[model samples]
Target: MTLAIENGSGKATQWQKVMVVAEPTRESAAALHYVLSRVVFDNDILYLLHVENPTFWKTCFKKQSSSTSREGGGCYGGCIGGDVDFLDQMKSACEVVHPRLKVKVSRVETDAKEKAYVIISETKVHGIDLLVVGKRQSLANAILGQSINGTIRETAEYLVENSKCTCVAVQRKGQTGGYLLHTKTHRNFWLLA
Candidate 1:
């Protein structure tokens, strides 16, 4: 799917508001950082968003309630700390590299489908000029039942199919660890990771 992008009036094009779909993984973190480093302008506002399954909290609650650990000790694996930490790291990197950029973080609890809708809606509401998403696995591999990214890959596909803003899906090349495929942004570009 493609959106009708209005070209700048013979002036240099700059993204003002950029939103990156983030997950608690290396690929997503890399994608966020890559976009911040390559596309964001000094005055741009960057939003780092993560859509989490609400059931994750329920499971964590159950684990904490039935825990064998001491009071105030809970399941760190199920906590949102990892996600928040990842965002913080990205924000710090952005500040260091693009000192004038503003960074914002948001965590939304919802299912995959609702997550996609929320992303699209938020982009429109925030007037985002660029939307970046990271795909954990190849689309072909995911369709072949080798899914690793799971809901994240689906959310990325949904954004590619439905978002009205310029959307880029960053996919990591296997093993090589330095090649990235930027899908669905007028032209497909490969970058060294």
Candidate 2:
């Protein structure tokens, strides 16, 4: 499958279906919905994937086990986590714009690195023409100098460089309601220049 974006001027062009991969986050969900609404296409599919990375829990368990000498050591109370159904949330969110869009949800338990590989592989298996991902913002990226955005950037660059499909990284920006006007004005200025 090949995804092509064409300006809706006066020309004949082929339109391929677009696949959007949205993680279950408020920002990501909002951005996905916004992009889908803005884009005019006949064939489009939205894929929502929830990846549960075990590294966070593994590290937490390791730290708790090392601090105590009991056979079953427990420093912090073990509480049940991972019960949140992100896929369900995504489904409900997408249902708001039903009939106009086709949405699919999948839940996978894998680390970030493994998840990235799975996404790439699935893109091929599912005949995805384009891959859309969200850019996450965290304080660690600001202070610790590492973040999910960096991983996404590296992953996107590698995929775009190596794969045959097109990749897009969508970020949630504040709605100014002047983007269209700004772009047109800029274009006019450039033409005059």
RMSD of 2: 9.4
Give lDDT tens digits, candidate 2, residues 1-193: 6455565886545444455555555455544655556542444566665555677558766666575554345433332224566567666766675555667776567776776677677777777766656544456544644335555434433444455566655445455431111121121111110
Off by over 4 Å in 2: 2-16, 40-43, 55-84, 137-163, 177-193
How does residue 81 of candidate 2 score in lDDT? Answer: 29
What TM-score would you give candidate 2 relative to the actual structure?
A: 0.56
- Each candidate's TM vs. the true structure? 0.70, 0.56
